[model samples]
Target: MSWMSVDIGENRWLSVSYYCLRQGVSSGFRMRNWELQGCNDGLSWQMLCKHERDLSFGEQAHGVAGWAVENATAYRHFRILQTGKNSDAVHTGVLACAGIELYGALTLACCGRCAALVEIDGRALGSAAMLEGARAGEGVRGCSRALRRSGGGTRAAAEKALEAKGRREQREREVR
Candidate 1:
């Protein structure tokens, strides 16, 4: 059986709470007796669900076949393998797929991996480069809001940060 796989990546991999798929445009290319599989190492596959020979997709070209996936583990890779041939007179595993969609939220590992800027009682955290106002601890790298004062509102703070970013870029260009 032939198969195709997609890598969601470890940084923001999906948990696949639910999934929907559409069949190919042509009736002869719709999926028949196909299996949806998942994998972590990409070599060894684990079957999540098996779909029997169904003609619903062939009936409606743009028809959608959806399933509620109940999986505890979030995989980095997902694959669909053609297990059996269709009702075509000259049977061949040359079917086509319109599209496949996997819906899920980001895992815990992806959280707290991005920079955040917050303010409390006029004191801002994550912007130690705001020397014009007041800075204390270390600043966050690649923080767009890393150079703003409290006197200025959020818009003014963003403008100030942009100005600082431009100056840093200019310095980098000069060094190059």
Candidate 2:
């Protein structure tokens, strides 16, 4: 019985999720177990799920899908372990991975943890910075249909927000 382990991390820190798709029968062997591991400092590694059944199992697999980790202080990195049966068997593991996104509760004054423009009365609120947006108490950030004044007309704030977004989009394109 032979086993293979592949590291999913590089130099910089990253958090990624991967799903394993069985390509074909192990010719003369069979896969037994698999697991997921997480490492913060890289040196100290911890296994989240151990020897669990192949979660992302599929018949015909395309390929592995993965993404680099972001602002997560927790775990970051995972891989699949396919236990080979015999030395003569030809077993293949196709991995597909993507970044796991966790969402939290949203508040009326804020856009929660997600990156979205704050809006009220059809007005668009600007983000505080790259990773943050208008706080709950920082007036209105953006305008939505619900945030329009009692007259049910587009507010100046909303127009400003929209224009700002358009300019930002244009700037992004130019940068690219």
Candidate 3:
């Protein structure tokens, strides 16, 4: 009846994991039967994984479920549909645990362009030329290396800015 949907940004994930609320015999509200579905348009859904009614997490502490989408087709939209509830929760809806962690490698890659220029390891790296010089998919690490390539002057400036910002924060804290 109820479902939790996810938009995998502009990239696709090789696999996904779901973390539930609780587990064990007392898990009346815990999701028992569910289906992991995928769709590119969000209108038509295709089944990815089907979990039948069972208390499989006998010793699994975290109530975690995961699977790799072996179809190899890149889907942008994904949903975990609760098909059936526990006998104790027969009158209720929703079958699987909701997503707590969203893992996407591309999300980090997408932000590398701007995040690198912002700061890294408490140092401020304000360099437009460095970012422009770097290629896509290099991510934060590549952008950082680009900053280093820009020479010691830029790196030194970033260090000073970080130090200055720290001093400013300490001063504000004392005032407060």
Candidate 4:
């Protein structure tokens, strides 16, 4: 089996609940059984999810194929391990992906007090004064709006973070 991993750039916590995989220009390639794992130290790992059936783009040349979890797990690193593939008799054992999207909330614990200092496109959105006066929910909403106004990838990231936060809150309520 071949595998590839992505280091989320930091050891911060993230509640990754959704993933989208887009196929590259090559249409013939497809993945069979695969596993998605998460870890904090990169050495000790835990399986987050697995797919036994085949995952493919089918007739679509470039499209998104994704999945979402009811309960998200917090981790700092993630990996994709491909155990099998669907191909002709002569298999070169090469798997390629055009792009992958991970959606989740960046945990407040990861941000600490500095979360209020987050910046987007060189502009500071979560100023100390704003965070001090903002309510819990209001702060999140404000940040989301600021990120959207800033535009580009920052907005997307903020959206995911808020989604994850919402999901986490929901789960906690259920538990209580």
Candidate 5:
């Protein structure tokens, strides 16, 4: 029903924990689950984790925990989702909340002498320098690397760019 920032770190990973309880034994559990969402700005949050019950056991604690998405855009806020509540419910009880925490670090890659950039395409697109120095010509909209072919191709040196499409087309024409 409510959300708050629990903690922070200079790093990129985030961890958060919280506790809740029913108004009374007969009133029943007012909240059934918890969720973790993320956002670039503090405005919109995409659901990272969802619909989880209390992680603790036999402790009679309504505490659910979730982790922030790795490499998620910096989050300025967090939220809680609540369900299963009614006004006349005799089983209702006030839930006490406490001990919330969050932590994270920057996401990066270092492999030997070569480093990979996160959120950038072509790093894992097969051979290095294959798609290097390639560019899409003007008026050309965009190229989808998802359809890129790799290995044993005639255009092996071609990077996944709009320009590569032009080169591949020219090669096909020459072959004909």
Candidate 6:
């Protein structure tokens, strides 16, 4: 049995709703029992979820080996512990994972009425500032049909918000 973990950095908390695991290209062994753990300080861990299915290479190759997290807990660190493998005696307990993907939404303010700006995959379809401007009784052109219909206020706030968001994303990318 073996275990592997990854740190998702600090300050930002992730609301992980689902996870995807892919088998390594050179490995034919499949994980039998696995547990996913989450932590805040990376010292104390909580069991997020566990699975005891056959994660065979053939099944994972078709992208059918993902599971939804029951509660969608927000955590800063995650660990994957493998306890068993579906292989012969010579290849027992060998763990080989090619890739793992976490899918979830980032906690962000949506101005109470701009839920439409967020897509089904937890991605914001538009800038937060534009949504906030629309909520603040300002007209944001081309942002949404509803906003365009209720046209009136100046575009100053929306523009400022978009600029700030752009700068923030740029800084975050640089940090990464």
Best by TM-score: 4
- For candidate 2, give the lDDT of residue 113: 36
TM-scores of all candidate predictions against the true structure: 0.59, 0.31, 0.47, 0.60, 0.34, 0.55
Q: Write the per-residue lDDT of candidate 3 for residues 5-93, one digit (tens) a residue.
A: 87855533323333233343344556567777778788998886687775655444346544444454445687777787743545467
Among residues 3 or more apart in sequence or in different chains, the pairs in candidate 4 whose N, CA or C atoms overlap within 3 Å are 105-161
Measured on C-alpha atoms, candidate 2 has an lDDT of 0.35
Better of 4 and 5 by lDDT: 4
Top lDDT hit: 1
TM-score ranking, high to low: 4, 1, 6, 3, 5, 2
The models' CA-based lDDT, in order, is 0.60, 0.35, 0.50, 0.58, 0.37, 0.58
For model 5, how does the per-residue alpha-carbon lDDT over 65-130 read when each residue is reduced to its tens digit? 334344434444555543333222453323334444444422212223322211223433322222
Query: Once all C-alphas are superposed, what RMSD does model 6 give against the true structure?
Result: 13.4
What tens digits encode model 6's per-residue C-alpha lDDT throughout 117-142? 52212334344645465557664323
lDDT of 5: 0.37
Total colliding residue pairs, candidate 6? 0
lDDT of 1 by residue, 52-155 (tens): 87665646566778887777666779988889885455655765677888765433232232344444334443332432233322222333332222232334
Kindly indicate the candidate among 4 and 5 with the higher TM-score: 4
- Candidate RMSDs in order: 12.7, 14.1, 11.8, 11.1, 15.1, 13.4
lDDT of 2 at 1: 24
Candidate 1: Cα lDDT at 169: 70
Model 3 TM-score, all chains together? 0.47
